[model samples]
Target: MDMSVTFGDDSVAAAAAEAARKLAEEGVPRALADGDATLWGGEAESEAAIRLGWLSLPITSRELLPEIGKLVERVRAESLEHVVLAGMGGSSLAPEVICASADVPLTVLDTTDPGQVRRALADRLDRTVVVVSSKSGSTVETDSHRRIYEKAFRDAGIDPADRIVVVTDPGSPLEQSAIEAGYTVILADPNVGGRYSALTAFGLVPSALAGADVTRLLDDAAQAREQLGADDEPGLLLGTAIGSAAASGRDKLLLDDSLSDINGLPDWIEQLIAESTGKQGRGVLPVAGSEPNEAGDELVAGIDTEGDIEVHAPLGAQFLIWEYATAVAGRLLGINPFDQPNVAESKENTTRILGEAGDGPLPTGTPALVDGPVEVYGDLPPHAKDLSDVLTAVLQDIPDRGYLAILAYLDREAAFDVPVPPEASFETITDIWAAHDPASLQGLLAIRTDRPVTFGWGPRYLHSTGQYHKGGPQNGVFLQITGAVTDDLDVPGKPYTLGRLQLAQALGDLDALRQRGRPAVRLHLTDREAGVRHLLAAAREV
Candidate 1:
């Protein structure tokens, strides 16, 4: 194996060891390797049976190397060097991590924000080759992206067939559509679920197209596959640690990637672990935030960052071990790890809202406090006068052992970052420099609370941690920040604009959470730039 695993605190080591012993006695590793369906019980057996195809991918995926190589060359030959991956969840996250770790640039469109979507369409359109990847073949965001891209290509007088590549299951709706449209389609392994498809065509197609050495990645994972399922191996040990930690009341897994050689790995791990095990009203919250909290209920884990356990590995092996570990953790938690049952509620809600909304402005709740560019839309304390008080009221609702999720439904990617808070005091230069990062919002607020705080971008996170928020433990308090879209873009073939779609998705998730009886508040930014600045300043006040 090309991975090295080192255990940190001995606090959960005993429980972890016991978990491993139980797994070994039950032959869990061997059973997983052999594609046993009953490992997660009868309820999950059907899903597990088909989902276990990922177990064979390190070996089977090698067959795709030549095809991927030939395709990459063909794209190059056609002068379409720019690669845009239109996907969500597993389809986009895995490749984003893979390409970033390999120091390659692959444009990923996993969002419905109009500004963000517009930016991708405007960048190098003539040289672009879009890889439309969707495990379900009917993901709304993916379908919308494909439609817009097709229109863009046609408008530029280019054949969509020459620039569009579809990666999906063999018999999926997307596969059929690609065939009918005369576009190239790459079939993914039918047995592998979306989250577990890092080694499948979904992860490779766009990555390889963007100039990553995917053949070498397969070689690395193949080497690790032979021994990972063993009882004493790194994969099993790591899974045992995770299961034991969560079961022992340390449910928040703070993923510290500050010192990692792999760029943007925590986000990928967040979805894999969160979606896989975050169900049955029990789950581990993967905190991919800027800093780990001082709360004792949190288990600080790391990629190359130091914590309760540190993992160091090649990108390919990292994917394999984490998948294996997540499965094992699911067993210890007594939940079916392969299924995301609550993920569809928001999607369904969005569809219904869009159907009934027509051209009307989406409804909004009565505002509790309206301060300049920011509007507080949810219930806050009676004494909450200013924006800072509203922010404090939202954070105050976080229970003793609960988490706070900051959901920003705006084009945060397109937003620029200003300097650090003037009143903040830092001992290290690194901390000062890190404040300028656009992904630093949750971090600044994270410093305000001793509890675990997580941040997710709009619509994109709907496919990620949105599952856990509704299905996992009911101890999370949500702070949903939505923006009034200043520059809106229309969907080429739909009645709704991208901004409208983004707001609807946010409302959908918020409604879903409220239906679950979770405490939440909505804060609308009438002016994004000023609203964000005010929010950050309010964070300091909080």
Candidate 2:
């Protein structure tokens, strides 16, 4: 599954080899020149990464299962139809994963999307209980969302005090909010990052809703922790591998196919990897959940092209296996994975984005152009029989670095054989949201377009585009394509069919564009991503 390419003078082979060497040595407990083994940084950059991997091991006791069970029961007993977890990053994502995997109907709002908040409140509010989740209780997003929920309840005529819940450290700001609100507070175990919090309240929300065999989950987690933490077992080996990799200037990229199954996990992994290892201008990347995606290739190209050391962790990978691999890698590289140094970027971005509005709206500056525009539209005039020819023609016509956001709405069966624009080639494409791996994808698109162009799916784009596209300049040229899926799932009682719903959303978004006095063109396709690619090729031909 490993491929090598010779791009100019960049020798990825050597870079990759050195990274591998670092991963190999990180685990051995070595005395430093300063006479400290565990006291100072290790050999591998992945050392810290490997170290962080151990936290996933579940080492809790059977004795604690009952406490968790009772907590679940209490949530049910409170006549709460839905629990709103209000934490950011790791604290909130684990629970969201549980919900998605169990396919529960309960709503979990993990983002600060006003539209999402509005939907949650409109649907739940009086009927559902809200869980405000924040481990530190000081996460700005968590607090901001909490305020949103508070205002929502107040507006809905519900006593804000009675409608909300808080989950956080015992004395955190979130806990204070819960106290002042007169609602239930779930005190999560300290020492766990928001991502690791999944084992705690992070896992509880969905467990309570979907009746997940959390007892079994906890058992698995506990087993992972116990087995990995052992002094001489795979834990040591894995830790060594991680340490080695980090020291050698090689980073870790966690590739999990279970990403879609575990909703919100990709984001959690990003935060964990960024915060845990990105200290002192170095760190391992935990890349998860870009399965069956076009974005994957672009991501790999970015790394392999630049010769960034990487480790791809597949779905359902053994916890110990990864631990040992990373540990050994870190030892070879020389760094710590336990500390978060560059975590300020996210906060800074958020602050800047929020500040730009200054009580007005998010400023939409010029969009970054990385992925040159590929004519990924499926529906096109001047149709041709040979798709390849069409694709070549379409690609030749567009700007070199534009991203064509495709939307065919076509079902899987009907869209299997669609042709891709020549420029539409990607190193990877995940089934999940492409935006989650913002840094990786952004890097890829940057390289492709010599600018940054992004592809966004529906529902999510509606929330994110308002400030950027409308408030900002016409940096992004939206394709706004639509198509029909072969088979549609019809849920009874819904106002519109899913197909119609897609069209409506597209229209609504286009209307938003028009309101901004922006110009957008819509292309109708027979398939979603597939036909869009096909049409992109066709457009190039013209």
Candidate 3:
């Protein structure tokens, strides 16, 4: 692994070294290895469930190396052309990362957007194997994706059982469903939590299906495992840097990867560090996917692979390294890295709002479209004019040590009712929209404000950064942008439409933020594309 670190100040480095020594003396690493939850200031029984599962992933992955190889061989024998993983958060991120280097065509459906869902099912339903993955097997998004695809497969005169695979804990509802439906079922370890299951079946099976070199990946992970107990282990050193930096007033973590071939790795790390440690009024803010030159109270780390090695080696190494570093960071932050307590609030709220849905008009407000490109909605303070004015108003309330969080409830891609032409595949559409729109919004916000700007897509962020916004330090100024869902789809076993469900989640989170007394603004746009354009224009004006 070709990894290096540099601190903005010598004092920061000295403090990190001291902290690493103290942590070693206190046996933090050993406690983590032994599955002791004592380092976290909480009842042991309460935190015990999440501690041990991730601790053994590196070793377990190595043990399962042969099994992974056999599975890949079986997949090849079956002549499966594509694999679509229907999962969210932990269940999805690792597969997406591994598939970046995959030879087999793999698509991960983590969004409930009807258009994206349709695109995933448009052409590949025949020779494609759908992997329905959820640790608990009951995630709404995962189950919903499975239901939609199953219906599509059946309608197309295909036997869904022959083309479906289930990845979940034994006896999970999804596992039982898969068994009853005669689908291939691969039971993940029951103890491993979703976010920490990168090295477990949740990640490895997909890696194999994608035709990745699982043996080499496991070899790299095994190397990372060997460094866990050493005093100067790379994982520990990085963790110490993160822990000490946050403790010394540099809580904003700027993570960048120079490896162009690997995408979404930073997003995975963002969830791991943010959701795990962002609680009890202190957390580390991971800034990824965007570049901000101003490093005020921020720790910047660049992750690069050695030029001589294959991408999978260092990529696999990163999985173990970050997992261990985050555990160390959790110990230093006095929190349990395994459990996400606040993640359920938005879910429950969304369910309640859906249950209460009736003929009532959707909860939406008009934005004030003044000289700016986008309109402002919700409570826009007293004198805000356009979306930019609303952002400027929100900026005024940011504390000296605070950051800006741009939360978008807009669909990641435009919705389509008809099947896309074979000439223009899902990948083509993604490539078209890849460079424009919200991709530049982060840089624009960073250049406009001194405070660090973090961007998160809706409902998805509800599972990732939403935990931090509510449970972490109240040093965030939230600007939530929501737009009209023109083509809505129904979620199976739910009372509301997918569009309505998304709206409910957005409203639920916005309400939750306000209830916490955090400074937040909601902007409702009539047009999604225009809304983004106006948002960028507003950001530039600010």
Candidate 4:
């Protein structure tokens, strides 16, 4: 498809079309010649791969199902309870997806929430299974989690040795740790990226947790991959057509609602697409989900007027369209799409922290707090009693952090505890309190501290508080929470009804905030029975 496919901007399309023809005539599969404004720099590096016909179909040659099945069986035989996964980016995103899709209930200590860590371990202890996952066997967040688990297991009287599983490269330090600690180990495929690891061990942990039919999920993914190879990939042509428009001075944006568990999956895809295809000045501006209703229109303003928005459903099949869109966009703009700028520093950061070789101290204890009044707002649900009942109990029972600020819009309230000493037992209590809240029908309390808390919130909350969360500030730790994928609102039936769209927008905003590096966590439910019980478990104790 050449560049004539645009939204009535014929001149730009004509320009792109002329460039496309020239590149084709020069024996290029899909590349722009000198000074073309449509191709990205990253794609240039992969010109050889494109020329060798490696970019057309089946970008990978790995088979992951068998390995996942074996992992599941091993967990089942061990009678494992909770699962704490270690990994960041792609390695972690896939497992997050499995957790979202699974049929059974499983607790994921995915984010770096000390409260989450404490709560996850407190009740289960020896019964919990820790899965340390990193493609390079060196993700900092994963490594930190591993160390925390080590401390937790020791405190809980559990043999961290038997309860741990290492998923990484074949002969890395993580593998060595697992071996020395007497934990089971699994190696990630060398060829897979962190984001791509979901179909592998990344997906296996949650699948096993939920007791999902791994074979079926993998079968679906395999089918989706095959469809991408075929001519039927839903948005492939549409996206490519959009790319043509982008090359013609039309920037693009992607509105996707798939793989919401990995809070920042869309953002990750955005980089993969944008960096790979944004050539010269011609590229797509990627946006996922809506944090607040207003933010969408803000981003939409710039792109929709000149470019197009490609909407995607939550299925693996649609990924092909984005991939192709990037490929074509890169060629039209004369840019390479694979070379990432400053990506090495990111990788190095992950490794240094995981290995505890970084310049900063491994942060622990309560975060430092600035003296101020803690304003309490928002009406407590009728059943929640009063502010003190919610605040004191929550603050006391939930995990404790050094600094905490709670803001509610309805009422003006503040707590000036002169030099409130940091609580020692902050971690586990907070997790229990969080899991226990919804049952009591308590108004939620979102706490933030100036500490690194690894988390990923799914897309569901983007429509609600996503805007304030992201545009606000980098102060305090953030935990964006949501439930698993279930019955979605039937938007078609209620075109004017905004409930469904609002839900999706909240999810999208959540995705945006996560992309900016905020931590997120999602709780999935098969039904209300256990979920309600778990969410409200803290209330009973109170």
Candidate 5:
């Protein structure tokens, strides 16, 4: 696959060239070759384990292709009708991209939303093979999903072990659990971080199961790897472009792909770049699936994958290129690419909240109904009258080089019901949130605030953008929205329902933001549609 990058203007191009020159002078190539962490920052030694593993993934994946191929065939021959992947962030995103373009049937269950969980396990329990994927066996969301499905299979008079597979690092608790449970286990390289494991078993196993050509994918990645090692590498050039643009005040990366088929590619890249580089008060923000902007502070990189094949070589190449470029961009930004210092804050908060649930009722602030179904929790910031007002206020408070992030805990499909039947098609339940047409809301916010607006779905975003929001710069102004989960689904043996889990995640994240002194507010809405209308009205008011 051939990859090319063109800058928006001559100044951006010149900046990239200078950044590349500096990287060469700083001995980045040698550092990468020798697995030195100096390029990351002063704390390279501490983050060495996670940072160096991804460097060799392309080569390692190539060597493992045959084994992966055999495993794929074994699963296919079992005649499973659907393969469900339960994971989050790095463990799930790459498989999602492959499933989108492949011939095999696959469904990804990353959200703890009971509705989504039910949808994924609804029908076809006997014929469905569930891939419980997590780099660390202990991801709460993934474990919750695994348990839910385990009970579902038991209820259906099926052996959960017969239909289960595990993908995780060796010796992780999840590996032992899978082994004890009699499920097939695939051990991933311990050194590869979740975001950088797309070419490893984490990504390849699912791609192969989806009937995607894993060989072609890895072959393409190998080609890109060769290019990355060259003196005038595209990865370095692109990284220079990104780093240079960020340095020149165009830190917002507006990524575009001409092929609609490869849209998910950008979503995966968003997490890769955002989580990897967005930290230590300086980072590159990737804008995907949002309105096009020509702001002076924006740098647009268009990806044109002109043709479609069973195996998306271009997409595979892109995975490698971005990984390389993001590392390069990290070196330029003077931050450790592998360490997510703030991501654990929210997780810890969520764990604490969950553990203390027995201490008392979950805290709920007095709800103040704004216009329509919109309601404000606790105290609204001064000058904020409604949901829209609160959002507008947050937008106004964005600092220089800051971005506005909307964290909505509402159901993505707006269906408040629980435990959708197993026979229902996954598509019927995975509809994009309609209440606040995200694209329209994003465009309005961009025009009004003249800053990037990122829309993150509940719990799911916690795994992806949450790292950047808390660990990156302090420039973000967050608007967290929570709503009533009318119907709740229990996790069989667990004490809480999926609805409770979702709310806990939201509250925990909101609390973490406040603790960090980040400007943020929580709005609890009584109705999804009314909440959205009120939000749009507020944007119009501005």
Candidate 6:
């Protein structure tokens, strides 16, 4: 099993084979390889025309090798060996997998949580070199991170230009500002979108600095390039199988990466699949980091796990393959894979909420019910008794064929210090959730329902599956978990603090979900640790 995808020999596989045959006859493989925007019809042309740059990344990204290597050597020579990646979504997710697979340590700051940001700021400030990456350069979270790090570097008597490297599109705001600031700037291909940019500078820069063999990663991707363009190839078969299954009502994609040599690939796949195809109220919902169950409306795929629809690949090729397959899947779903129209709803709401709030505290509404350390915020039934009742109501609200999304806007690394049992372990929220019903809020809630459960750290998922929750199908009930920031960290030049930003983001997304008439419940942990314990206890009761 090497950089290939094999479907089952049953009727399901036969149907997929037929879909692939039809697609090949329709010239999908060749058109996709040729970067033809017309493959997705007229509506997707403008975005698709540019977003297809990922197809050429394997060949085009190699030119950055010499410069990146030289930069790494210079940084290490200056004793700046600690690589802190200040990026969100595609900027952060790919290097995480690369560094994890290479067994190298890379501190990825992709959160607005005060504790998480403070933790990153406190760690190895002297030897740290921050890689600030943003495709659009206007991402609030990344911008915030850049500002704080610049302040920290300046306060430490170190010039930010020597300690910071910027990765953005050639003319992005960050690039222009970084050039003026005298910081090292690495321009990503302007043609590629954030989620589809694993092979671009956004992925390569951070991983190379962290001592990963990024050159080998590109080499592996190139090896699979020719195969992806031909009929009956892994990319074609995979795209058609998953796409057609989804078109036939199996819209929930159950991804299992347990047997893969690639570390933390599912999250990347989750963002890729969810953000790309999840729009126009139609998309494939990627249910990753869960115990794969044989559900009626779900398609279970394993990365290197020998079962139905077996997918095996090097981490590099894995990124390219899944990306191409997702594009094909989007074609079948009749949605633009390149555009994320609904993702900005939350961001716009956040901005509006923040702007309206100004320096004053964000509007805090009364909770529907206060149970122990937890304050439940939602339109729950009036007769509901306690937290368990709220849990029951939320779980019951999940319609048949619907899924549960637990979006935690708290510090993602809050659980990093805890110990895991020998059977399972995890590095970060970017890593997979333990499938063995581990003592987690998601695991506990999962036991109460049979529907697919997904866990995402907020602001991070805002760039990933955030699109799906708003633009995808209506069959999703969200459980938003926000916690009280014990010690808030203030952003250097912003009117809002990190804790406030996190809360506003959570509230903004909640408002958007409610506006869509989606069933959403917000549980605020007024006492972070105690609330977590009580929430878990209530989930267990349910």
Number of the top candidate by lDDT? 6
Candidate 3 segments exceeding 4 Å error: 1-9, 42-46, 62-71, 101-104, 259-261, 305-313, 365-375, 413-436
Clashes of each: 0, 133, 2, 57, 3, 0
Candidate 5 segments whose C-alpha is farther than 4 A from its true place: 103-105, 258-261, 305-313, 378-383, 414-440, 528-542
- Model 6, span 378-477: residue lDDT tens: 8899878899999889889899989999998877667564555566644533243322111277777777788989999998999999999999999899
TM-score of 1: 0.95
Which residue pairs clash in candidate 3? Answer: 367-376, 368-376
Question: Model 4: per-residue lDDT, tens digit, 297-399?
Answer: 1122111123333333333333334444455555555555433332343234333333452334332213122111211222223444432344333344222
TM-score of 3: 0.89
User: Worst 10-residue stretch by lDDT in candidate 5?
Assistant: 304-313
> Which has the better TM-score: candidate 2, or candidate 4?
2
Better of 3 and 6 by TM-score: 6
* Winner of 2 and 4 under lDDT: 2
Worst 10 residues of 2 by lDDT: 365-374
What is the lDDT, from 0 to 100, of the residue 46 in candidate 4? 47
Provide C-alpha RMSD values for all models, in order: 3.1, 12.4, 4.1, 15.6, 4.5, 3.0
**Candidate 2 per-residue C-alpha lDDT over 1-542 given as tens digits, one digit per residue, 9 for 90 to 100:** 22212222133344434443443355333222111336335443343333342354354324446665766676577666766655555555456556655666556554433334455556656667666767677765456566666666776787876656566777786677577668767676664444345566555644564466666555555544443433333334334433444344333343433323334444444444334443443445443333213332223212222322232221122222333343343334344434443333334444444444455532322222211222222333354335444333333333332232322222222232334455543642232223222222223322333222334444333322222344333333454544554444322333333444444445555555555444444545443454444444444333
Point out the worst 10-residue segment of candidate 1 by lDDT: 429-438
TM-score of each: 0.95, 0.54, 0.89, 0.52, 0.90, 0.96
Task: Note the Cα lDDT for every prediction shown.
Answer: 0.86, 0.43, 0.74, 0.41, 0.75, 0.87
Q: Report the C-alpha displacement of residue 47, candidate 5, in angstroms.
A: 1.7
